[model samples]
Every structure is written in structure tokens, then in C-alpha cells.
Target: MDRVWEAELRLPTPLVELRDPLFGTCRVLLKRDDLIHPDVPGNKWRKLKYLVRDARDRGADTLLTFGGARSNHVRAVAALGERLGFRTVGVIRGEERPTNPGLRRAQERGMTLHYLDRATYRRKSDPDVLAALHDRFGGAYVVPEGGTTPLAFPGLAELVNEFDRPYDAVVCAVGTGGTLAGIAAALPAGRRAIGISVLRGAWSLDAEVAALHRSVLGHPLDNWTIDHRFHCGGFARRDARLDTFLARFGDRHGWAPDPVYVGKALLGLSVLTGAGEFDGETVVAIVSGPGAG
Candidate 1:
């Protein structure tokens, strides 16, 4: 608890223009959440802010969290723990190898890595599993995968308030549904939100978002929709089309996006805008992470 994290470190990021000729008067802007902070950036950090504060308020010494091998959420938690002064334990989805980038970075950040098979990982929030972890790691705070807890909604809602002007729509890639819900909940009247799902055949993300939105904001939200056409196979799965788009986008903009999330999202945004779904209206797409490679 010796390190000082300035309250003002939660800097507001700028929005960038993503040019495409066909859109004509319609503008495509990118909210640069990926640049929020070097170590704890994007929705990953936005989603963790309140959770970390709550954990410290409850006198938690360690934050135990769950995620897949390449989860940005796990990386954010570990990095936050180190930078903000807290112990961390990462319950990884598989028996991840030491070379995995996310796992390696988490370990470097002083987060203890715990492995469980796929089946066990699915039951991560199970009372028995949580109890076992508590028994082993003491009274640590637990952050669900993707930091989807109710407390996180407030931090994410802050992102929506960043716009000085109204946008017709805001878009982001959805993993655990928390980010989408937060954006939708905080949007002013007349604006909308969209989520390009990066996962397929898992639990219903829409249901999860709906439930979380209701839990946090006390009502159902009707201002957003989910587009699943960009999964590109599944979470962390890629295809040639997505790869080609990523390469071309990077070449054009000098920004390489991770295939898992940001790439698909930009592609979806391009498609939707080009198709006139958002023509003549100001649109904003979220760049949620710095591409890993």
C-alpha cells in the first residue's frame, strides 16, 4: 500500500477519426480507451476500478480472479494489483504454459497463478470452488472473469460521460457483457450502443448483460443491441478474412489490432457504417485494447 495512485490518473481519452470514403458525411470515430494507461488500459481497467476500491475498503489483502489463458481481464487485474499495491491470485482456465503472454505478465506483476482444467474453470464461481480458494488464499476479494461485478458499472459508466458531443451510436466488442451494459446504461437519450460479440456458443451474453444492467441501474435498457456476425470462429479464434482485415487496417492506420477483440469490432463497424445503418450520423467505435502483437 505504499505506492500512490493519483485520483486524477483516470484521464479522459480522445476520440479519433477512422476514414472510409463510402461513408461520405457519416463519421466513424474511435474512442481511444486502449490508451487510458500504459499498464492498465481500456475496458479492462475501467471495469476494475470500483472493484479494487471495494476490495481495499473491505480490508482485502489479495484479489483472486478467474480468466482464460489470454484474458485481458486477468492481465489488467494483475497489473493493477502491482501498480496500485495489492496481492493477486489468477485462477487461469487451463493449465497454461509459462510462455503464455497473459500468464507470464501476471506472474511478473506478483500475481500467484493457479491452474484448473477447463471443466473446473467453468465452475469458477461455484461456492465450493470459491470456498476452497478462500481457504487457501485467506479472505481475498474475488473479481469474476472480465470484472463483471455490479460495482464495476460505475467506473465504466464514467466512460460514457466523456463525450462532449452526442454520437448516434457507440460500439464495442463484448466478452462478458459488462462493458456493453455499462455503456448502454450511461448513454443519454437518443444515442444507442452496439456490441460485436467475440465469443460464440457460450452462455447467452445478452441475458447476462440484461441482468447486470438491471442489477446496476434498476431497469431494463432498450438502447443497445448485440451483433454476433464478428465472432470469427470464437474467442481468441481467428480466420483469414479477419487476419487480412487486420493487416490492411494496420497498414492504413498504423495501428495493429488484436484479432480477438478490436479487429472484429472495427470490421463490424466498417460493415455496418458502409451498409448505411449509421449513415449521416456520428458513430463511435471503441478501441478496447492495445493489440498484443
Candidate 2:
């Protein structure tokens, strides 16, 4: 429990006030999870909170996790590890790049960086990769990519504590389904939870959400749902429309969105609402990260 805890932060990015004449009427409210920390920001920080505490409790001197070369999770974990007095090791996908920003930041923050090919990185979710990592790191505590695990759920469940209003629905961009699952578990009787997946073919998100629910609450949640059509060409891919939206969003709200995560999610919500999916309900959209612009 002696590990560093990033403060719980919130910001109001204009709610459903912007209207698209062709689309329909909808309000856009942003939950600024990105501003939760200066370096290890947003939902990433929330998910890692319990993990960091557990690492300290177990007397772990080093933290090991896996992600892509430019993963926001890796960058945030590196920053958090440095602040929390823990050495970090990130098993990154793709060939090693001497000029990778995430890698350079990790190195600057004293994190040991490990590179693996895409095929090998694909094995990261397997227990074998974890075992191999443990052998190499020698007692480094392992955190899953995206800091996902049962423990991470409760921190997100606590998000309901931050809101004082009655939101008809809670929405967020789903990467691994942790945040969406957490919200479903934390749902008050009448509220709906919606997840906009950033990955294509995210049909698996439902199963993942169910697993998280079972792991955290010891039961599957029956309430929440996912809308998978808005991935916008999957992670890191963007177009002019999204770019214009991001620019306008920043100009209007004074917040930045990384094209990979929040931008896609935000754009997805707009598309969904414009299609009359969110017709007449008050919704809270969780802006999970300010990972990159």
C-alpha cells in the first residue's frame, strides 16, 4: 500500500451540445480519465493502481508487462514505475527501434526494455510467455497488457462514486474490455453501459467482458452491451473526418486525443449517436486516455 497512487481526476468536456445537422441530436460528455496523472494518465493509471500496490506488498522491486512498441500502456507503466520506485520491463512487439518514443521514455525512466517479434508477442497472453518473463526478470511482478486483471476491476467500479448525476447510460472505448466490464458490474439498477470497441472484429469483447465480470463480481453481468461497428479501421488508423473532429474537439474542449484510443472511441460514439442509436438518453462517455496526439 506504500506504492504511489495517482490522484483521481475529472474534467468536463462539453456534453452533447455539438450537433451535426445531418446526423441527429446528441450530447457529448467526456469523462477526463486522461488528466488523472501527468505522465501515467487516465484509465491506465486507474487500472495499475491495485497492481502497483500489490507489487509493493509482495516486495517486488521490478515490474514486468507486455505491450506493442508504441503502446500507451507501456509508456504509462514506465512513467508510473519510475515514480513508484520500481524498475520496469516492457516486452514490446515488433523489432527493436532505437528511436521509439515509448522505448526511449522507458529507458530514460530506467525501465529495462525487451523487444519481441509480432509472432512472439502474440504469445504474450499465454502463461508460457509470463513464465519466460519471470525466468528472465527473476521475481519481477507481471501485469497484463492494458493492466487488466481482476484487481483492476474494482478501481473502475469505484468510478460510479465520481458521478453525482443520474446518467441513463455509461459509454467508453473498449480495448481489452476491462473498463466496460467494470462499469457494467458497477451499474446502478436502471443505467445502461455501452462499449465502443476500437478493434475490428471485436465480437470477442462480449466474452471478455463476461470473464471480467465473473472474475470481479463472482457473477456475470446481464446488463451491459457493446457496439462493434465503430472501430474506424482499427487501432492507430485515422482519416480526415476523424482528424477534423479531433481538431475541433481540441479547439472546443481544450483536450488532446490520441488517434488510436480516445479519438476512435469518441468518433464511434458520434457515429452511433448520429445513427439514432443513442437517441434520447443522457450518457457519460469515459475518455480513457490522452495517450498520444
Candidate 3:
């Protein structure tokens, strides 16, 4: 079995137009990675690519990964694995609830879901926990939560090639910081890369971002930075205004915005663009996943 399943997709051309006149100052283009794969979509699909390959190369029949109560990564990976005939397992953080929709969906998709207490889940980054999972799962390949690794970044870097016009800035939401890191590494010099934080108490993501640059790009990013002001009380936080914005934007552009990634990215982009952050230049915001459709 091939580790990485190449998702069939039509990579979008340059300059995604904004239907909102409010964002007219700067031209916004979207690398429609959302269209990358039907099942495993967008940056998640790319990040999972080499990891899946590595898993297969290691002779693993099962794929194990970690995620939150409502992780897009979980949704994508479970569906991808089931479609590809690999037994899938999701080590989900937080208590298993009778009403968790994402978990239910994952289970319905045939993924073995393991619910872990927050204390144990918090230690997911530690090698000991990973080793334990490996031991229990009998050598199942473990992909770090969100598949954020050096291998993942290189695939995301290829997104830079799809844009024709030189961009003044590129913005994306940071979860594990993989997507932004890859884009920053691949973007041309003088272009600014801004990461909008999505995880609360995620102060250490900058180090992850920097490390990705060094490892994937073979250099360091001194100019790129992150904005943590509007994580909106952490991941999965909701506001009526965000819903309205997402609905309106999607209606105009015929795109869907999932609450986790693209929703926050659009939220930050709205604020930053309104603040004249892109007043004198063109900006490209990576639309990481497909809209509600």
C-alpha cells in the first residue's frame, strides 16, 4: 500500500477575488487547497501525504493520530484512511461525550476512537506517550496531532508556486503552525507571512513555526510573525458576528468556511484588512479547507 494517497485536485489559478467591497484596498488571492481532495482536503491532505507514505513504508497497517474533540484533521484522516483500506485510530483529547458530533462521525467512518483525559492528552508531545501508543497499537505509525512535521511543510510550500502575481503579504491561521510555516518557507523574499493564532495558550507555536523554517526551508524566518490577539478564547469558540461574516462571504464567493480554520483566518483577515494592514499591497490568504459544502 502506498503511504501517501495523492488526492486528485485542480490547483486554483491566481488572484481570488473578494466579493466584499470593504476589502477592496488590497487584492486578495486564495490558493484553493480546499479543492485538493474530496475526502482529505487542503493542507491537511498535503501534510498527511508523507506521513501516510512513511507509515506504509514502515509496514504499518494502521494509522494513529491525535486531535481535539472536533478536529478537522480527525475528520479528514478518518475518512481518508477508511477510503484507502487502512485501519484508522484517533486519539482524541477531552472526555468522550454522548453528544460529541465529530467523534460520532469519526466512529461512524470506522475509526477506532480513543478518548483520553486532558492531562494525558496534554502529554501527547512527549515521546513516552507516543511510544506507549505504538506499543499498544502494535507498531502502528503515529502521526503527531495535525500532522505538523518537517515533511508536511514541503508539500505546503508548493502552494507558493500557484500564485502568479507577487504578493505583498500572505496570511493563514496557525493550529500546529505547519501550513504557515511551509508557506513562509516557500514564499519569495520581501513577502510578509502572518499567522493568526487559533489555539488558546499556544504561545510555544512560534518555536514550532521557526523550527519548521529551519528544517524545511533550510534557513530561518526573521520577518514572519504571528498575531495572537483574536484566538477568540481558543479553538472552537464561536460568535454570531463570525457566523454572519462567514455566511456573507461564502454566499458572495460560493465558498464554504469551516468554523475551525478558514473561519478564523477570514476573521483575522477582515480585521487586518480593515486596519489597512494591506493598504498598499496585494495580499493572498490561503483558504485552507472547503466551504460548508
Q: Show where candidate 1 strays beyond 4 Å.
A: 1-3, 7-10, 22-25, 96-98, 291-293
- The digit string of per-residue lDDT tens for model 2 on 26-134 reads 5555676776666766688668878888998999999998887778888888887877889999887777543476678778998888887788888886788777888
**lDDT digits (tens) for residues 1-293 of candidate 1:** 22366453546888877786645567888888888877778887788888898998888879999877767778889988988789999988776543476678889999999988888888888899889999999988988888888877788788888876668899898888888898888888989999999888645888888998778778899999999888889878898878888888778778777788888888787778778788689988888876532
lDDT of 3 by residue, 4-29 (tens): 54424555533465557757587877
TM-score for all predictions? 0.93, 0.88, 0.87
Give the better candidate number (1 or 2) by lDDT.
1
Window of ten residues with lowest summed lDDT in model 3: 1-10
Separately for all candidates shown, the number of backbone clashes (residues 3 or more apart, or on different chains) is 0, 4, 4
What lDDT is reached at residue 198 by model 3? 76
- Candidate 1 vs candidate 3: the lDDT winner is 1
Ranking according to TM-score, highest score first: 1, 2, 3
**TM accuracy, model 3:** 0.87
Task: Say which prediction, candidate 1 or candidate 3, comes out ahead on TM-score.
Answer: 1
Q: Spell out the clash pairs found in candidate 2.
A: 15-28, 16-27, 16-28, 33-42
Compare the candidates by lDDT and give the number of the best one.
1
